[model samples]
Target chain A: MSLIIKDLYARVKDGAEILKGVNLNIPKGEVHAIMGPNGSGKSTLSKVLCGHPDYEVTGGSAEMDGQDLFSLSVDERSRAGLFLAFQYPVEVPGVSNANFMRAALQARLPKEEELDAVAFYKNLRARMKQLGMDPKFTARAVNEGFSGGEKKRNDVLQMMMLDPTYAILDETDSGLDVDALRIVSEGVNAMRAPYRSFLVITHYKRLLDYIRPDVVHVLYNGRIVKTAGYDLVDYIEEHGFDFVKEEHP
Target chain B: MDTPAFNDADELSGKLRLALEQAEAEARLREAETPDRLNEDWRFGRPHIYAKALVSALESDTDNAGRITIQAPAACVEPMADDMRDGEMRLRSIGSDKILALHLKRFGKGICLCIDTVLADPIIITYETEGVFTPSTIILAAEGAAARIIERHIVRGSGLLVATRDIKAMAGADISLELEVSGESTSGSDQPRAMNITNIAAMDAQVRQLTRYSGLDWAREETVAEILHENTTIELFSANRLHGTQILDQHTRQIHSWGKSTSNLLYKNVVDGSATATFAGNIYVAPGAHETDAYQANRNMLLSEDATINSLPGLEILADKVRCSHGSASAPMDEEQLFYLLSRGIPRHDAQMLVADGFLADAVTQFRGSESDGNNTKI
Candidate 1:
């Protein structure tokens, strides 16, 4: 099973086109990394996949395990096992992290079912402890007043809590220092399982070092110009995207 | 009865008539017609149309006994004496003279709550009345005493309620007052409305007041606080949720007459449907009241496109070396915040509710924080 995309085209609502005829397939149990230059529509791809309202998809289709992704709403896509770790997580004021997480998990359950509060808290505390997050954060507002590193860790903590089938990391490594990067990568690594697939989007090879990917694709000018094995990460680290852009042009 | 304060009902009516005449003369001299849109204090409020109805209701003499129920510690409960009522009447008024005069003319029965020692349990007062119910409450906290007072106004049938509270916090005293107004539309009952006017004078004490309104057709609240001595702290908070064309009008004033006093006010409203809310707050520091720290903020979250909010924040600082600020903000729910919650699988309606609830939770948090402190201040 895989998340298949065919000739995807998207653009900002009433604005310039950002993604043009992009295709990629992330099979289950495999992690794929997308390396792209600035303004190459990497972030746009993630947002479009998550059904962000700011952008409109003009053509093509994306399916998760044969189920059409565009057919679902933003929240429906999430409950259907699609997750996007925001590049810049939004701050939700006055909603405690614990309550926010509990609501998300509750949404995944049936109407007649009830979430076990005690077990929820116990599991949440365990996940937080695993991620090196302070216990007090559970009581704090979601992502509010949090530092860059703390926000990233909180995002990973949420991903762990939700346990989606296919996760997209949109520049999750941005603004993270070395120590924070290590901890965040570790959290992502722990969530890797046989039934889950990940699409790690980043600019630098430093992130790929912590959470190595099985395949690396070079996206240039809103299109994937080259797709190769992990060696592409090192090749680009050495030569940059100039050669790929030249070849694509 | 042990020497009734007044000989007969005629004497009581005479005293009330004198008070009403004095109030009307004052109103006439000030050229204060029923507050309308032209009035600065009533610009966004529609109290003018109901002014005649309210006055006529006050003019009607309806005995409203046994409608108010009070559950309090026996030591702190007592009947309001005539002298105590007169003394409270002499205190500076905070609301419009027209309404206060009508309230005074109709005010006959009330509770005089005196807290001389720390009280662990709150004084609960519930008002279940209809058609021009006016009750006066006097809360006097002795030095070093701490107490909590909760007033619940439950409107079953359509009527107008004019309630006034006079609070005095002595040196080193700590007091908290919570007022909740909720109503239901009964069959064949006209619109239900309520006006709450509160006045507070604090001297080297800590006083906190919180008022919440929900499911009320219309409500108007006027609060005035005076800092009489140094080391006094006053916190005022209101969290209101309005739905279905409900209207909430609020007016507040923080007067700093002494130096080194602190006062803060926060009012939050969530207006859904076609409801509307208006908040007007003023912070005034006397010429010599230096080192005064005061802040006022009014926040509103409009849940629907038809919902409206009018906020006016004013600060007049006549003293130097003081720090004071006031701000007002009204906006629809943040799209990014909504998307963030929605992206987590929360349904749209539930997501909006969460954001709206969080918008008002800040004020409740501050009030509850102060409450806990008051609870710990018992000595």
Candidate 2:
């Protein structure tokens, strides 16, 4: 079982293609890091996987365990065990965090069944503690008037609560401070299991130090030019992406 | 068998005389028979009906009574000797369609209760009348000072009550009025009340008012405000809640005669059961009142299968360089908002209540914290 991106092509708005031809397989029990410079389609891949309405998938298919994820709506893809930790999470005014999470959880229940409130809160509090979030955050409106680090940490909180089979985290570490990033990385690592996987997208190699990935991919101009192991992240850190840009061209 | 065509003053005098005679005759009839829901005039909605013996029972008990409290200026204590002038008012038993008339027997010529800012408490007026018709009248005078008044009318059993009020907000004065109506199930009758508020605002004077009515079998509250100066400002807010087959008919007319005058009117109604609520507001900017700014809005919410709301918000502008607009909208509760709340585990009824409370909260907030004259009101 894996998240297979087969000959995937995507465009931003009505512009020319961003993700020209992306092909990757994130197998279960693995953590994959896709590192690239700005505007290299790293974020585009996450949006395409989540079936964002703004992006057009010109050609390609994304399959999770042989079921096409690209064929589903944004919410449907989320229900089908695909999660995207947005770089900038949306602020929904007057909707409390607990209520929003409850809606997301309720969407997963069977037609006749319901989630137990007691169990839901119990699990939610435990997950929140792991992410270093204050208990009071549950009552506040979702992501409203939050600082940069707080919003990033909140994204991790949603990711942990959702517990999807395959998660695409786009720049989840950009705005987080050292402590917040470490805590958020720890929360992500805790969700790692034999049947779950993650594709962490980042511009810098800083986050990889906390949650080591099983595979590393370097992207240049909307294409993955190199694929290696943990050592590739160290190479990209020691030497910047200039060499990669040269290799892709 | 025919009458001659009279001049303007003569015709007006005849009309005034006829109106007073009709009012007195209706008042006498109201003292006798209790009005019921089946009465032709009450074909819309009816209040509670209490037998004449019930008034004696209520008077003897002295325990539970309908309460009303007024707050006004110190000069109100002096007897309004000149207020009974002829041709100043033309009203008759409120109206036959709504409330009946009853007698008010205990009042001296110079009995004036104090309702100054120092009192700081609701001057409650209680009535324990059990008869078919319970007619009551209170003459309020706010002579150049500002105040807030909360007038509450409640009934225990079904009975018709026709009430009248005369308020004078004199030159450079302000007044805020809050009218609340709520009661338990009583036999059906009509509750009609007429308020004639005369405002003589000098240069740069202001007046503001809010009337809130809730929980009555049937209510028809009417008001007429005349602005009598330049640079005068007036605002009127009306909120009504109706349940069962209750019908609420509210009519308001605002007249502005001076330049640079401003007036705003807003009405909100929530109707359930087969209840019906109608709002008719007319704003008149006279010929000489240039630079007049007036606006009116009427909004209604229907909660049940048979509820109805009718709105007629009108504006007449006779002056140049005036900005006047009025709008009315009637809509059901937002189903998408309800679904969004319910999907998050909030029960359907609670969600609807939250939405309804949000819809009405803005109108209620205007009544708190301060009086209409920009002075802080003592709690």
Candidate 3:
């Protein structure tokens, strides 16, 4: 019924510690936002939750609906309904977007079951249209030669297609024009349901205006220092993380 | 009637017999000299061992009945001549001289196809062979004709196949050739090897050639193209996937002998599990071949840490007002690309396969689109 992380500590493999004793709880049916300063481990938390190979958890426990997250592989976490919208989507050459999406959806089926090609294309085209993407993108390589705005849109498109139970938008609003942000926000809003949860991580308050969160937490020095209503966004916008750090100290 | 009492048919037959005998003698002499690692073309492959195996197979009395099959439109199939004159001439004009000589010496009686009109269906020639098999095919496309031809070689057991293909395109003609080589082993120790030599002459025409190799223990392929007239365009592409200690060695040459002609070459290989691949491509522009444009590229994707790839791209331009470029790249699978697919619920092996497929996508696309009109390949 919730994503629970307790005393989570992680570090880059053979490198510096990134997430140190981070704890948070996101229950189903609510959207939570994490606001922090630069180098506050916002992105690392997302990657760690999705089981990126570069980071190793030294001391931590994460459970999705009472199921241990660390026990599964990276891809297993995805099929288990945990999704991360990358800040900078990687460009894959020679693999068409349609084909890539098809492979992903196909993996969810049982070994004896086969995906319906007709229904797949129909659903894909509808989703693409909803996102304002050109029909030609389906045939083009995944994110190859795509603009910044286009890449962000593609990331959202993938999130929509996968339909994970818990989705993390990791700095998804970093590089977007006003129109693109609106469209992407709309796509995220449409996917919200009572059974699903979202963790929106961002630096600016501008994104909160579109996809307002029920709770906003201030993460400073790898720990959640304050939790408040939407008013905390305005206070941080007016002031900054300095006030939060001083209070925690 | 008082002229020399010589029957033209008998005279021509006698001349052909003499020519065959001389060609066979030359081939024997060439085969006597073993190709070792010192030879530039044979350095990466075990040509010395292949040569010995070929010589022994040629000496063996293996019956080759029903080994070759051909399916073509009745009108497009031309009666093959009984003489080896045409095959000998074409073999000498292109391909490695040593390999050509061996082919002539053993299996000189080959098939000849003459295409004079546009055909809707493709002509398929298949060779199923074991032991030592040598086969040659000569294709001549008349003026304004268009055709698509597929030549396939399937090998089993400890098979050794040496193949020669010579293609000629006349003015306004369009031709596409697809050459595929595949092999399987009946026993654990069975080793399958193949050597293919292809030569093309394009005269004010468009010609496309694609060669694909897979499932072979070892293969060596050589292709040479000569642009003989202005407004001629030649495209050459190859895609090979090697795995499990497999080795593929490729050599290509694009000779722009006339002005205002264009030639392009692209070869891609995905090496996995200790496989090895080598490619050497050269673009040669003659002194008077001005306003010529030529390009060559060889790309390799190494899937495993133990996989190896060697690429050498060369350009020798002796002409003014010519544009020529060549490039070679070999690298492991992109980690970022792999993770992108993996994050979407795809397994690690499937993700790697997708990336590898994308790496060689352009070559495959270009080859598949060869017969279509107005082919504008980005590669």
Candidate 4:
């Protein structure tokens, strides 16, 4: 019924600890926003969730509906309904966006089975149109020449296409303008079904204005210090992480 | 041995004599009044490889493989010109004993075809000589008619085979030629040796030629193409994939005789399993050949650590107002690109195969052209 992260501790490299004893949980049909300032380990939490090879989990356990998550590889975790919209999505040259997404989807299909190209393209076109993306964008190389806002929108496009059970949007609004942000939020909100969950990690509350979160958590110094309702975003916007900083200090 | 003079007249004759005598090849040699290499046209950069032959015991029970198909371009005629089949031409059928010979040449305006009608599915023209062997040459001349031809060389068994072909396209006549060669397990248990020379003259005409050699054991090939005329253009592309100790050395020369003439050459080599490849290209622009443009480039990729590639691209210009450029590059696969594919759930070996296939795909793109026929590529 939920994704539970209990007593999580992670390191950037060999012994450079970044996440220390963090705990959070997001039940089905709920949207949670994690707000933290720079250098707070919010990004590390997203990367660790996706099983990035560079980040090592020393002591932690993450489960989705009672199924262990850490045991899966990065791509396996992706196929198993966990998605991470990277803060800075990678630019893969010579690989078109349509082809990359097709490969990812093909990996999830049964062995020796083929993907229906006609149906797949039709679905892709519909999703792209809903996100206000140009039809020609599917043929262009993945993020090779995309602008900052275009890259972020492309990340949202991918999340929408993958349709993961739980999506971790890592700073999805970092590079977006107001118009792009609104379009991305609309795309995300359209996919907000009762069976899906989202953990939106960002610094600003402007994104929460369009896609309201059921709960808000203040993540500071590698741990979630406080949890509140959607009004917590307003409080953070009024002041800052200083209230959480004072209590933690 | 020392390198011969750049303008040696006897080089062609000498090569013909040695090749004809060693392989006992039969072909009528038209003696050029200018002594084949008498002028500066034939020899600009001397191309020679250290010769050595490993004559293995001949196998008596080698299976007979099927025939190889050599593709030639369909005939085309200009708007107001006479058919090229009636032009002056000379045909030569050499090495009919052990080699399936077929030569088509149109220098001025005639069709000359010399075919050894007897088809040898897997032909092997071996070199039995003890010293350096000269490759036989097939001379084709077209007075003014356009011509398209194809020559396929298939080795039934392993044996050292040395051979060459010389084609001349006369003034205002276009000619396109292709050679496809491959080898198999032979009775002799030794690979073939091949030396090929092609001379093309496209005076105010356009010419395109492509050569592909692969699946040879210890095969060595040398190709030389020269373009001579005003407003004439030549598009030359060559690709070779060699395995084992196969060594391929290719040299190309483009001469700009008149103003506004253009030439381009792209040669690629892929070597694996201790194989070696060498590419040498030279572009020459003569004086008064104003507005001449030429480019020569060689790219090689080594598939294994033991494989090696040697490239030398050069340019010589005598004209003050001309554009000419040449370059040579050799490198291994990109490690970052490979890692990225492997990290995406594609197995490491499958990832490597994808990269290798992509590397060779670009070289083959030039060979394909628009076709209205329904037999276009299904892929």
Candidate lDDT values, in order: 0.87, 0.65, 0.85, 0.64
Whose lDDT is higher: candidate 1's or candidate 3's? 1
CA shift of B304, model 4, Å: 6.9
**Candidate 4 regions off by >4 Å?**
A6-22, A39-45, A51-70, A148-154, A174-178, A217-228, A236-249, B1-379
Candidate 2, after superposition: displacement of residue A40 in Å?
20
Q: Is 1 or 4 the stronger prediction by TM-score?
A: 1
**Top-scoring candidate (lDDT):** 1
Taking the tens digit of each residue's C-alpha lDDT, what string does model 1 give over B1-379? 5854878899988988877965655454244355556667777776566555666677675665427889899989888776664544544443366666666655666778999998887889998757667888889999998988899987656767778888999999999999998776776445888888888999999999999987678888889999999999999999988988889999999999998999999999999999989998999999999999999999999889999898999999999999999999898889989988888888888888888888898998889888887644431
The residue-by-residue lDDT of candidate 3 on B1-379, one tens digit each, is 5644546988978877876877676655465454566777666666667655655565563544327788997767666564644455445322246656556656543567888887767888998868677777888989888888889999887788888788899998888888999987988798888888888999999999999998888888888899999999999999888999988989888999998999999999999999989898889999999999999999999888999898988999999999999999888888878877888999888888899989888897877776576232112
Number of colliding residue pairs in each model: 0, 17, 0, 18
Q: For each candidate, what TM-score against the reference?
A: 0.92, 0.53, 0.91, 0.63
Q: Which is superior by lDDT, 1 or 2?
A: 1
Evaluate every candidate with DockQ and list the scores.
0.79, 0.07, 0.79, 0.22
Q: Chain A alone, model 3, TM-score?
A: 0.98
Chain B alone, TM-score, model 1: 0.89
- Pairs clashing in candidate 3? none
Please rank every candidate by TM-score, starting with the best.
Answer: 1, 3, 4, 2
Residue lDDT tens for model 4, A68-179: 9898766667778888777887666546778767776777689899988999899999988988899999987677789988888888888887788999888899889898
lDDT of 3 at A63: 97
